[model samples]
Target: MSFLSALRRPPAAVRLNASYRATPCRSVSTSIPAASDKPAKASATATHTISSCTEGTVLGGLNWLKGQAPVTALADEEYPPWLWKLLDPKVIPDDGPGGQGEKVRLRKENRKKIRDVQFMKTQ
Candidate 1:
Protein backbone atom coordinates (compact mmCIF):
# COMPACT_ATOMS: atom_id res chain seq x y z
CA MET A 1 0.00 0.00 0.00
CA SER A 2 1.13 3.63 -0.62
CA PHE A 3 2.25 5.71 2.43
CA LEU A 4 -0.92 7.94 2.25
CA SER A 5 -3.24 4.90 1.96
CA ALA A 6 -1.42 3.20 4.93
CA LEU A 7 -1.98 6.39 6.97
CA ARG A 8 -5.77 6.31 6.35
CA ARG A 9 -8.13 4.65 8.88
CA PRO A 10 -8.35 0.78 8.78
CA PRO A 11 -11.54 -0.94 7.50
CA ALA A 12 -14.37 -1.02 10.13
CA ALA A 13 -14.48 -4.85 10.02
CA VAL A 14 -10.67 -5.05 10.77
CA ARG A 15 -10.97 -2.43 13.55
CA LEU A 16 -13.88 -4.32 15.21
CA ASN A 17 -12.05 -7.67 15.01
CA ALA A 18 -8.77 -6.20 16.43
CA SER A 19 -10.53 -4.34 19.34
CA TYR A 20 -9.36 -5.52 22.81
CA ARG A 21 -11.68 -7.93 24.70
CA ALA A 22 -10.78 -8.31 28.41
CA THR A 23 -10.56 -11.87 29.83
CA PRO A 24 -12.98 -12.77 32.69
CA CYS A 25 -11.28 -12.06 36.08
CA ARG A 26 -10.32 -15.15 38.13
CA SER A 27 -8.89 -15.00 41.74
CA VAL A 28 -6.77 -17.85 43.24
CA SER A 29 -6.56 -18.45 47.05
CA THR A 30 -3.41 -20.66 46.90
CA SER A 31 -1.53 -18.51 49.49
CA ILE A 32 -4.38 -18.72 52.08
CA PRO A 33 -4.24 -21.55 54.67
CA ALA A 34 -7.28 -23.81 55.43
CA ALA A 35 -9.70 -22.62 58.21
CA SER A 36 -8.89 -25.75 60.30
CA ASP A 37 -5.10 -24.82 60.42
CA LYS A 38 -3.63 -23.39 63.68
CA PRO A 39 -0.38 -21.38 64.07
CA ALA A 40 2.55 -23.18 65.82
CA LYS A 41 3.46 -21.85 69.28
CA ALA A 42 6.83 -20.02 69.36
CA SER A 43 9.48 -21.62 71.64
CA ALA A 44 10.98 -19.35 74.35
CA THR A 45 14.81 -19.13 74.38
CA ALA A 46 15.05 -18.12 78.07
CA THR A 47 12.83 -17.33 81.09
CA HIS A 48 13.25 -13.90 82.76
CA THR A 49 11.82 -12.17 85.86
CA ILE A 50 11.45 -8.34 86.29
CA SER A 51 14.24 -8.38 88.97
CA SER A 52 16.54 -10.53 86.72
CA CYS A 53 16.06 -8.29 83.63
CA THR A 54 18.68 -5.50 83.32
CA GLU A 55 18.39 -2.16 81.35
CA GLY A 56 20.55 -3.78 78.58
CA THR A 57 18.36 -6.92 78.26
CA VAL A 58 16.92 -7.49 74.73
CA LEU A 59 14.34 -10.12 75.82
CA GLY A 60 12.08 -7.33 77.14
CA GLY A 61 12.67 -3.83 75.63
CA LEU A 62 14.49 -0.93 77.40
CA ASN A 63 13.03 0.62 80.61
CA TRP A 64 12.50 4.16 79.23
CA LEU A 65 9.92 4.97 81.99
CA LYS A 66 12.57 4.75 84.73
CA GLY A 67 15.38 6.48 82.74
CA GLN A 68 13.47 9.70 81.74
CA ALA A 69 14.99 13.04 82.93
CA PRO A 70 13.00 15.01 85.50
CA VAL A 71 10.88 17.83 83.97
CA THR A 72 12.02 21.37 84.98
CA ALA A 73 11.12 24.93 83.84
CA LEU A 74 13.95 26.96 82.23
CA ALA A 75 14.95 30.31 83.88
CA ASP A 76 14.87 33.64 81.89
CA GLU A 77 18.69 33.67 81.71
CA GLU A 78 18.71 30.19 80.12
CA TYR A 79 16.20 31.16 77.36
CA PRO A 80 17.61 31.11 73.75
CA PRO A 81 17.68 34.29 71.55
CA TRP A 82 14.72 33.08 69.43
CA LEU A 83 12.63 32.46 72.59
CA TRP A 84 13.68 35.89 73.94
CA LYS A 85 12.64 37.53 70.65
CA LEU A 86 9.16 35.97 70.94
CA LEU A 87 8.76 37.12 74.60
CA ASP A 88 10.18 40.68 74.15
CA PRO A 89 7.56 43.35 73.16
CA LYS A 90 10.24 45.77 71.86
CA VAL A 91 11.63 43.23 69.35
CA ILE A 92 8.11 42.43 67.99
CA PRO A 93 7.81 45.79 66.09
CA ASP A 94 11.45 45.84 64.83
CA ASP A 95 10.73 43.34 61.93
CA GLY A 96 13.94 41.32 62.65
CA PRO A 97 14.17 37.47 62.43
CA GLY A 98 11.06 35.45 63.61
CA GLY A 99 8.66 38.27 62.48
CA GLN A 100 5.87 37.31 59.99
CA GLY A 101 6.37 40.52 57.92
CA GLU A 102 10.16 39.97 57.82
CA LYS A 103 9.68 36.35 56.61
CA VAL A 104 7.28 37.43 53.80
CA ARG A 105 9.68 40.25 52.70
CA LEU A 106 12.68 37.84 52.70
CA ARG A 107 10.72 35.24 50.63
CA LYS A 108 9.74 37.91 48.04
CA GLU A 109 13.38 39.10 47.87
CA ASN A 110 14.60 35.46 47.34
CA ARG A 111 11.99 34.92 44.56
CA LYS A 112 13.10 38.15 42.80
CA LYS A 113 16.79 37.08 43.00
CA ILE A 114 15.93 33.62 41.52
CA ARG A 115 13.87 35.23 38.70
CA ASP A 116 16.73 37.68 37.94
CA VAL A 117 19.27 34.77 37.78
CA GLN A 118 16.92 32.79 35.46
CA PHE A 119 16.37 35.86 33.19
CA MET A 120 20.16 36.47 32.98
CA LYS A 121 20.79 32.78 32.02
CA THR A 122 18.11 33.02 29.24
CA GLN A 123 19.64 36.24 27.84
Candidate 2:
Protein backbone atom coordinates (compact mmCIF):
# COMPACT_ATOMS: atom_id res chain seq x y z
CA MET A 1 0.00 0.00 0.00
CA SER A 2 1.09 3.61 -0.60
CA PHE A 3 1.97 6.06 2.28
CA LEU A 4 -1.57 7.50 2.43
CA SER A 5 -3.19 4.05 2.28
CA ALA A 6 -0.93 2.82 5.07
CA LEU A 7 -2.00 5.79 7.29
CA ARG A 8 -5.72 5.23 6.51
CA ARG A 9 -7.88 4.20 9.50
CA PRO A 10 -9.22 0.64 9.66
CA PRO A 11 -13.00 0.32 9.12
CA ALA A 12 -13.22 -2.60 11.62
CA ALA A 13 -11.62 -1.06 14.73
CA VAL A 14 -10.02 2.29 15.69
CA ARG A 15 -7.03 2.30 18.05
CA LEU A 16 -6.57 5.17 20.51
CA ASN A 17 -3.51 6.27 22.54
CA ALA A 18 -4.46 5.64 26.20
CA SER A 19 -1.21 6.68 27.88
CA TYR A 20 -2.72 9.09 30.44
CA ARG A 21 -2.20 8.43 34.19
CA ALA A 22 -4.59 9.16 37.05
CA THR A 23 -3.16 12.25 38.86
CA PRO A 24 -3.69 12.59 42.60
CA CYS A 25 -5.86 15.51 43.72
CA ARG A 26 -3.78 17.93 45.82
CA SER A 27 -5.22 20.10 48.64
CA VAL A 28 -5.73 23.82 47.90
CA SER A 29 -3.71 24.76 51.04
CA THR A 30 -0.57 22.94 49.72
CA SER A 31 -0.52 24.99 46.48
CA ILE A 32 2.41 27.37 45.87
CA PRO A 33 1.97 31.17 45.75
CA ALA A 34 1.52 33.05 42.45
CA ALA A 35 4.52 34.53 40.50
CA SER A 36 3.52 38.09 41.50
CA ASP A 37 3.66 37.15 45.19
CA LYS A 38 7.38 36.22 44.87
CA PRO A 39 10.02 38.87 45.65
CA ALA A 40 10.87 41.29 42.79
CA LYS A 41 14.55 41.56 43.90
CA ALA A 42 17.32 40.39 41.52
CA SER A 43 19.06 38.29 44.20
CA ALA A 44 15.88 36.33 44.91
CA THR A 45 15.30 35.69 41.20
CA ALA A 46 18.97 34.72 40.61
CA THR A 47 18.91 32.16 43.47
CA HIS A 48 15.66 30.61 42.22
CA THR A 49 16.95 30.53 38.61
CA ILE A 50 20.19 28.82 39.65
CA SER A 51 18.29 26.15 41.60
CA SER A 52 15.73 25.56 38.81
CA CYS A 53 18.18 25.40 35.87
CA THR A 54 19.10 21.68 35.65
CA GLU A 55 22.19 21.56 33.40
CA GLY A 56 22.72 18.90 30.68
CA THR A 57 19.40 18.61 28.80
CA VAL A 58 17.39 15.37 28.95
CA LEU A 59 17.99 13.32 25.77
CA GLY A 60 17.48 9.69 24.64
CA GLY A 61 14.91 8.92 27.39
CA LEU A 62 11.64 10.26 28.83
CA ASN A 63 11.90 12.88 31.60
CA TRP A 64 8.59 12.39 33.50
CA LEU A 65 9.73 14.47 36.44
CA LYS A 66 12.11 17.15 35.12
CA GLY A 67 12.97 18.40 38.64
CA GLN A 68 13.93 14.90 39.84
CA ALA A 69 14.93 13.31 36.51
CA PRO A 70 17.25 10.26 36.25
CA VAL A 71 19.81 12.43 34.41
CA THR A 72 23.45 12.00 35.43
CA ALA A 73 25.38 14.97 36.87
CA LEU A 74 28.32 14.48 34.48
CA ALA A 75 26.97 15.12 30.95
CA ASP A 76 29.94 13.35 29.26
CA GLU A 77 28.71 9.95 30.45
CA GLU A 78 25.01 10.31 29.50
CA TYR A 79 25.38 12.21 26.18
CA PRO A 80 26.30 10.52 22.87
CA PRO A 81 30.08 10.15 22.36
CA TRP A 82 29.98 12.07 19.02
CA LEU A 83 28.47 15.24 20.67
CA TRP A 84 31.92 16.16 22.08
CA LYS A 85 33.34 16.45 18.52
CA LEU A 86 30.92 19.35 17.90
CA LEU A 87 31.44 20.91 21.39
CA ASP A 88 35.26 20.74 21.14
CA PRO A 89 36.27 20.27 17.49
CA LYS A 90 39.53 18.50 16.45
CA VAL A 91 41.98 19.28 13.54
CA ILE A 92 40.65 16.56 11.23
CA PRO A 93 37.04 16.27 12.48
CA ASP A 94 35.34 12.91 13.03
CA ASP A 95 31.71 12.20 12.00
CA GLY A 96 29.12 14.85 13.12
CA PRO A 97 31.75 17.50 13.82
CA GLY A 98 29.41 20.09 12.19
CA GLY A 99 32.35 22.52 12.19
CA GLN A 100 31.89 26.17 11.31
CA GLY A 101 35.21 26.09 9.39
CA GLU A 102 33.71 23.84 6.66
CA LYS A 103 30.80 26.25 5.99
CA VAL A 104 33.12 29.32 5.90
CA ARG A 105 35.56 27.51 3.59
CA LEU A 106 32.74 26.48 1.21
CA ARG A 107 31.28 30.02 1.15
CA LYS A 108 34.70 31.56 0.38
CA GLU A 109 35.37 28.99 -2.36
CA ASN A 110 31.96 29.62 -3.99
CA ARG A 111 32.52 33.43 -4.00
CA LYS A 112 35.97 33.00 -5.58
CA LYS A 113 34.54 30.68 -8.29
CA ILE A 114 31.68 33.11 -8.95
CA ARG A 115 34.18 36.06 -9.33
CA ASP A 116 36.39 33.99 -11.71
CA VAL A 117 33.42 32.87 -13.89
CA GLN A 118 33.21 34.87 -17.20
CA PHE A 119 29.76 35.06 -18.81
CA MET A 120 29.40 35.58 -22.66
CA LYS A 121 26.99 38.51 -22.03
CA THR A 122 29.59 40.34 -19.82
CA GLN A 123 32.41 39.75 -22.35
Candidate 3:
Protein backbone atom coordinates (compact mmCIF):
# COMPACT_ATOMS: atom_id res chain seq x y z
CA MET A 1 0.00 0.00 0.00
CA SER A 2 1.05 3.59 -0.73
CA PHE A 3 2.06 5.94 2.17
CA LEU A 4 -1.11 8.07 1.58
CA SER A 5 -3.41 4.97 1.50
CA ALA A 6 -1.79 3.71 4.77
CA LEU A 7 -2.67 7.04 6.48
CA ARG A 8 -6.13 7.27 4.75
CA ARG A 9 -9.33 6.69 6.75
CA PRO A 10 -11.81 3.94 5.74
CA PRO A 11 -14.93 5.26 3.90
CA ALA A 12 -18.02 5.85 6.11
CA ALA A 13 -21.10 3.52 5.65
CA VAL A 14 -23.40 5.14 3.05
CA ARG A 15 -27.04 4.18 2.24
CA LEU A 16 -27.40 2.70 -1.26
CA ASN A 17 -30.05 4.30 -3.50
CA ALA A 18 -32.71 2.37 -5.61
CA SER A 19 -30.26 2.56 -8.60
CA TYR A 20 -27.60 0.63 -6.52
CA ARG A 21 -25.27 3.70 -6.29
CA ALA A 22 -23.97 4.72 -2.85
CA THR A 23 -25.66 7.96 -1.59
CA PRO A 24 -24.22 10.45 0.95
CA CYS A 25 -25.57 10.02 4.55
CA ARG A 26 -27.18 13.28 5.75
CA SER A 27 -28.64 14.08 9.23
CA VAL A 28 -32.47 14.22 9.45
CA SER A 29 -32.36 17.73 11.13
CA THR A 30 -31.71 20.03 8.15
CA SER A 31 -33.35 23.22 9.60
CA ILE A 32 -30.78 25.87 10.74
CA PRO A 33 -31.41 27.90 13.98
CA ALA A 34 -32.71 31.46 13.33
CA ALA A 35 -30.17 34.22 14.22
CA SER A 36 -33.00 36.84 14.80
CA ASP A 37 -34.01 35.11 18.11
CA LYS A 38 -30.92 36.54 19.95
CA PRO A 39 -30.92 40.24 21.04
CA ALA A 40 -28.15 42.30 19.24
CA LYS A 41 -26.12 44.38 21.75
CA ALA A 42 -22.50 45.63 22.14
CA SER A 43 -20.21 43.91 24.69
CA ALA A 44 -20.23 45.50 28.23
CA THR A 45 -16.44 44.82 28.89
CA ALA A 46 -14.21 47.93 28.68
CA THR A 47 -11.34 47.63 26.09
CA HIS A 48 -7.91 49.33 26.33
CA THR A 49 -7.94 52.67 24.43
CA ILE A 50 -4.82 53.86 22.58
CA SER A 51 -3.75 57.54 22.86
CA SER A 52 -2.70 59.47 19.68
CA CYS A 53 0.17 61.30 21.46
CA THR A 54 1.97 58.26 22.96
CA GLU A 55 5.43 59.86 22.23
CA GLY A 56 4.65 62.69 24.78
CA THR A 57 4.22 66.49 24.24
CA VAL A 58 8.00 67.14 24.36
CA LEU A 59 9.13 68.17 20.80
CA GLY A 60 12.93 68.59 21.27
CA GLY A 61 16.04 66.79 19.80
CA LEU A 62 15.79 65.19 16.22
CA ASN A 63 11.98 65.54 16.15
CA TRP A 64 12.25 69.36 16.57
CA LEU A 65 14.84 69.54 13.74
CA LYS A 66 12.59 67.48 11.38
CA GLY A 67 9.51 69.66 12.17
CA GLN A 68 11.48 72.84 11.49
CA ALA A 69 12.38 71.93 7.85
CA PRO A 70 10.14 69.85 5.55
CA VAL A 71 11.87 67.16 3.38
CA THR A 72 9.91 68.16 0.18
CA ALA A 73 10.96 71.86 0.57
CA LEU A 74 14.62 70.78 0.98
CA ALA A 75 14.42 68.47 -2.12
CA ASP A 76 12.78 71.28 -4.18
CA GLU A 77 15.63 73.60 -3.29
CA GLU A 78 18.32 70.90 -3.99
CA TYR A 79 17.10 69.73 -7.47
CA PRO A 80 16.14 71.81 -10.52
CA PRO A 81 12.46 73.00 -10.49
CA TRP A 82 11.77 71.19 -13.84
CA LEU A 83 12.88 67.74 -12.42
CA TRP A 84 9.88 67.42 -10.03
CA LYS A 85 7.41 68.95 -12.60
CA LEU A 86 8.34 66.26 -15.20
CA LEU A 87 7.00 63.48 -12.85
CA ASP A 88 3.37 64.66 -13.34
CA PRO A 89 1.50 62.45 -15.92
CA LYS A 90 -0.35 65.50 -17.40
CA VAL A 91 2.99 67.26 -18.07
CA ILE A 92 4.27 64.31 -20.19
CA PRO A 93 3.80 64.95 -23.97
CA ASP A 94 1.35 62.52 -25.73
CA ASP A 95 2.28 63.81 -29.24
CA GLY A 96 5.01 61.12 -29.66
CA PRO A 97 4.61 58.26 -32.27
CA GLY A 98 3.93 55.69 -29.49
CA GLY A 99 2.32 57.74 -26.67
CA GLN A 100 0.48 55.12 -24.51
CA GLY A 101 2.26 52.30 -26.43
CA GLU A 102 5.63 53.56 -25.06
CA LYS A 103 4.43 53.03 -21.46
CA VAL A 104 3.28 49.44 -22.29
CA ARG A 105 6.67 48.77 -24.01
CA LEU A 106 8.58 50.10 -20.98
CA ARG A 107 6.49 47.87 -18.61
CA LYS A 108 7.18 44.77 -20.78
CA GLU A 109 10.94 45.67 -20.89
CA ASN A 110 10.99 45.96 -17.07
CA ARG A 111 9.20 42.57 -16.73
CA LYS A 112 11.72 40.97 -19.15
CA LYS A 113 14.63 42.51 -17.20
CA ILE A 114 13.26 41.05 -13.92
CA ARG A 115 12.76 37.61 -15.56
CA ASP A 116 16.32 37.68 -17.04
CA VAL A 117 17.78 38.56 -13.61
CA GLN A 118 15.78 35.73 -11.96
CA PHE A 119 16.91 33.23 -14.70
CA MET A 120 20.57 34.35 -14.29
CA LYS A 121 20.36 33.88 -10.50
CA THR A 122 18.81 30.42 -10.85
CA GLN A 123 21.54 29.29 -13.34
lDDT of 1 at 81: 43
* Candidate 2 wrongly placed segments (more than 4 Å): 1-74, 89-108, 113-123
State the lDDT of candidate 2 residue by residue for 1-70, as single tens digits: 6543332332122233234322222112122334465476423321111112234432222334756655
Ranking by lDDT: 1, 3, 2
* Cα lDDT tens digits for candidate 3, 41-78: 23233322222222222211222253474212122244
TM-score of each: 0.23, 0.20, 0.22
Worst 10 residues of 3 by lDDT: 53-62
Reference-based lDDT, each prediction:
0.42, 0.39, 0.40
Query: What is the TM-score ranking, best to worst?
Result: 1, 3, 2
In candidate 3, the residue pairs with backbone N, CA or C atoms under 3 Å apart (3 or more residues apart, or in different chains) clash, namely: none
Candidate 2 pairs with clashing backbones: none
What's the CA error at residue 88 for candidate 2, in Å?
A: 3.8
Prediction 2 TM-score vs. true: 0.20
Weakest 10 consecutive residues of candidate 1 by summed lDDT: 21-30
For candidate 1, write residues 17-62 as lDDT tens digits. Answer: 6453222221122232334434552332322111222233232111
